[model samples]
Target: MNNEEAARARVVSTADRLFYAQGVQAVGMDAVRSASGVSLKRIYALYPSKDDLVLAVLRHRTEQWNTGLAKAVAAAGTPRDKMLAVFDFLAEWFREDDFRGCAFINFFGELGGGNSKVAAAVREQKTSFQRHVAGLVRDAGGPGHLAPQLALLAEGAQTTAAITRDPGTAAQARAAAETLIRCAFE
Candidate 1:
């Protein structure tokens, strides 16, 4: 990558890590510069503001979430299994050492009220996720309206897993999901 691109990537990665580990409000630009090894001047030139950097980090997190979920769904055999694969993805994610709830939810809690741009970004990301779940439910022979149920389960699982620090939370959600899917299919 070009120098600016590489620097920008480093800054975003550093910022994302810090923002996830600490709250976004807690991590300053100086910390990001120190962690990323990018100059403060360069970071400012690239991101313009902390809010801009946060937006980039949200985009990065969303892309990572989409890619991982897609991989899990693709590996599953049936549409129903594919629908269930979302929990499988969540299970793996919850098991990660640094798993810290949903990025959108965390970001929303941190800045959604004061920052209109961040709020909108969080909403759009969540809406996209719901749309994804809705498609999966429809494909799995569930009612179109049942999508929210599945999405809510997944969303709740993320929060519970983060709060409880338990990987099995995903499995519990999965079991609940199976019952819902079975009922929907019937």
Candidate 2:
């Protein structure tokens, strides 16, 4: 990759790490520079502003959510298993030492009210995730209402896991999901 791309990635990764660990509002560009080793000048040149950096971080998160879910679903053998794989992915994420719930949810709580772009990005990520769940439900021949129900379970699981510091929330959500799926298909 080129210098600019490399620098941008460094800034985004560092910022994302710092932001996730310590809310977006708490971390400054200077903090990011210190963590990332990218000069503030280059950071601003790449992101233009803290808002821009925040957006880049959100985009990176979006990619991670999409890719992780895709790989998890791809690993499952059946359509229903693919649906359950979503929870499996969450379980893995929750087990990580750095787990801090959903970045979109966290960032939205932090900046969504004051920032239009951040708010919109959070909304789009949520909407896209819901659509992804709906598609999985469709593929599994689940009843239509199951999509929202399942999505709620996952969302609630993420919040609960973060609050309770329990990775088993994913398993619980997966069980609830399995029940929902059975009720829908049976």
Which portions of model 1 show Cα errors greater than 4 Å? none
Candidate 2 lowest-lDDT run of ten: 39-48
Write the residue-wise lDDT of candidate 2 on 1-186 in tens digits. Answer: 999899999999999999999999899999999999999988888989999999999999999999999999999999999899999999999999999999999999999999999999999999999999999999988889999999999999999999999999999999999999999998
Q: Candidate 2, 162: how far from true, in Å? A: 0.4
Question: CA lDDT, every prediction?
Answer: 0.93, 0.95
TM-score of 2: 0.98
In candidate 1, the residue pairs with backbone N, CA or C atoms under 3 Å apart (3 or more residues apart, or in different chains) clash, namely: none
Which pairs clash in the backbone of model 2? none
